[model samples]
Target chain A: MLNLLFSLLFLLSLFCAVLTGKETETGRALLDGAGAALRFCLDITGSLCLWSALSELLAQTGLSGRLSSALRPLLRRLFPRSAREDGICEALSENLSANLLGLGNAATPAGVRAAKGMAALGEGGREELALLVVLNTASLQILPGTIAAVRASAGAASPFDIMPAVWLSSAVSVGAGLTAAFLLKKLWRCYR
Target chain B: MALLSLTPLLLLGFSCLYALALGVDAYGALLTGAKKGLTLALELLPALVILFAAVWCLRASGLSELLCRLAEPLFRFFGVPEETGLLMLIRPLSGSGALAAAGELMETYGPDSLIGRTASVMIGSSETTFYVISVYYSAAGVRRTGWAIPAALCADLACFLSAAWISRLLWA
Candidate 1:
């Protein structure tokens, strides 16, 4: 059913493109965009593979375990269900570890893992996952090294120049997103 | 040469600290979680590919421009300029498209320029609308997204306004 909907939307978009009278240019742009997306996917997949390997190695070497243990207290507060403790800790640690290294690509898998873990424990699927998505999207970090790397790769003069703004904006976005999620959740619960 | 040589040593040190803090008991758990992570990566890849292709097709077809035209007045109500309406629409569809548009604005108008600053703030703060909405709604099996769009758009507006105001206060 969802697949059908997605296909219909895609066809509609294509129709709109043709109707816009730049079918040729739009087709070219679409090709370029697809190429870019493919590249992005490849890059992200590679990063995730590396992150997974490192995470496994860290586990073999006992680092991941330690990180999870250390993060337990915080995780407990965030997810008070004792049954969900291990999953929450593991997910949070994986996310924070990747995030700290400024690997947006790698962090996504960890975030998904966290969401799945949360879902497994029956912690409100979509609503809870939406909060996580928002949190990840509005992720607060001291270093936006990934963006800087992209800037440098693109031949920017000073990749670090955007750091201050990145910090400020990320902070506000994360705060706002968390607040909204919390308020919305509370409101939903009350209304129900 | 020296910095490159030091990188491994630093990584090793961090790894050592990590192992010590996390300990041996949690190793099994970590492995389990990592496997789950891999599965998720596999699952999301195809959908992302399809969505990217579709968005690209839309852009190439010039549907984005028409959509932008339709959305212009709506964006203006939130204090975003008419020129940037295309960006708000594109940003949700494609990160690169949004960034490219923002980069062009920055290059033409200067990084600290009002439009550039606004774009920068918008980039970091706003959600990738349709993607997020669809994912969340589907995950919850929601048939009616009655208030969701309006609520999210309102949030987007707040984000835009706050970003503009804050950037102006600090940079301008």
Candidate 2:
């Protein structure tokens, strides 16, 4: 799937550039993009390491265990059988807690850990994985500090004024995403 | 904003203190977790390079802009300003790219204006859809993503529409 999308984008870009005689610009962008991605990887590594280390500490100290157990009832509803697995539940709870706290990039390592844990459960975890991806993609952040900061720097009189709108929209999106995921899964099973 | 920036510091401090209280080997655990993080980073690098290249190619070739222009009417029908067309399209593809677009829109339209507010709300609400899907799926070794992409894109659409509508309801 990624291959197909990437190929389509690559071909479309090539065709568009050729048509507009901007092939040089496209080539430069490709190289620059790759270079930037390398730099981004290096940059993110430090944060990922820090967050993952914190996650380990949280888990080892039973802090995240407490957090996960607290979150278990809700996660159980969302994840069903997968919530029964202690490993997956802990990883997921950490991810959810990070996200709720608006930890931004810090949430990814825990999310990745959760994803890996879900994958370990084999095919039965498929629906749970999809739901997890949907929840992450919906991204219900409580503070949304980054955007507010952007607005402030841009000189908005009330940068956090849009908080209500952000919250509402995020809530709506999560609902929409989950509904779509479940409906699609049902449809998929029927088709099979 | 200060509190926002201080969150990670507080989290780190509190977690470490808690770990110590629990008699956990925080240092060794950090080392072990860092190793895992490094491995995850290495695993992610190839996909990141390829995805970035694809997105950059579309952006540099003006294909993304073209798509945005073509989709402008649809966005407008959903109450999104036509000026924010590129933002709606890019928000799900790349986080930094969307931030840059949002910043540009706010600067051009004035952050107090409807377009600026809508863009800000949209950015705050939406996630990098393709990025999240790819990273999570790849990390989990899922070759076939099934309906994850479509479902997540559905969420992004809801986010965009709701952002525009709610922004207008309160600010317009």
Candidate 3:
């Protein structure tokens, strides 16, 4: 998929360059892209490092486990077939907490762990997995750190002034995603 | 809103308190995780290089303008400005791709503009649907993600549409 996307975009760039008679600029843009990518990575690294480290520390302290237990009622509601003892709740809750912080780097490991747990015990079929996937994809955000960082770096007067709007849009999206997932489950049952 | 953005700092403080309470070498844990993060960031670099460059080329090649024109009517229907059409198209496929576009919008239109605010709010609200699907499904050994695509895409549409509407209502 990555290869296909890369090649397609490259070809599109070349074709457009030829059409516009701006062929020389395309090569220069590619080099500039490389530099921008590096700078972008470095800019994000500090936050990633801090958040992931704190995440690891939280996990190590067994606090995530406790938090997971605290979240049991909700997790069970989301993944109804899954049991608390199965450890799915723990990972899912941790992932949720990380996601709530807008810490995708921190969320990744927990999300991966949740996936592994679901694969092992969630023989409940596609519906269960769909719920998990929807939860992750449309997960709500409080900070929206990465986007705010971009706004800040771009010299926005107040990078986070977009937050209230972000919070509203994200809540709406997640609600929409869950509704779609529920609707799809019913449709799937009819087909089955 | 200011307090919301400070959640990360709050989490950091919580970790410090937890580490102190547990007596579990908090500094070591932090460093260990940072090392892991550094490695992960490095591994993600190649994809970034390709995506950023491709996105830049797409815009510089004037292809973005053409694509935007094609999607302009849809954006119009959603009440989003035509300038944001490229972002709406690329957002679901790639997070970095959308980020690059948003950065450009911020630079060109200024982050406080209707265009920039819409871009940021949309990017903030939606996930990279295809990317998340591939990663999470493969990791969980989920072979048949039945009905997930439409479900998630619904959410993406919600984000896209609402970002335009809400940004307009609140900012403009």
Question: DockQ, per-model, please?
Answer: 0.22, 0.45, 0.58
Give the winner by lDDT: 1 or 3. 3
lDDT of each: 0.55, 0.78, 0.78
Task: Arrange candidates, best lDDT first.
Answer: 2, 3, 1
RMSDs, each prediction? Answer: 8.1, 6.9, 3.5
TM-scores for all predictions? 0.55, 0.67, 0.80
By DockQ, who's the top model here? 3
Off by over 4 Å in 2: A1-69, B1-73
lDDT of 3 by residue, A1-192 (tens): 546767888999999999998888887898898788888777667655665676667667766556556766787778776545466667778777767766676677887887777677655734666777787788577767667766766666777788889889999999999999988888988998
Candidate 1: where is the Cα deviation over 4 Å? A1-73, A123-127, A146-157, B1-82, B125-157
Q: What's the candidate order when arranged by decreasing DockQ?
A: 3, 2, 1
Question: How does the DockQ of candidate 1 come out?
Answer: 0.22
lDDT of 1 by residue, B47-130 (tens): 555555665665566665666688778766665655555466566555555555554445435555666666666665554655
Q: What tens-digit string does per-residue lDDT give for candidate 2 at B109-143?
A: 78889999999888988899989998999999988
In candidate 3, what are the lDDT values of residues B94-154, reduced to their tens digit?
Answer: 7767777787677668888999999999988888888888988998877888889889999
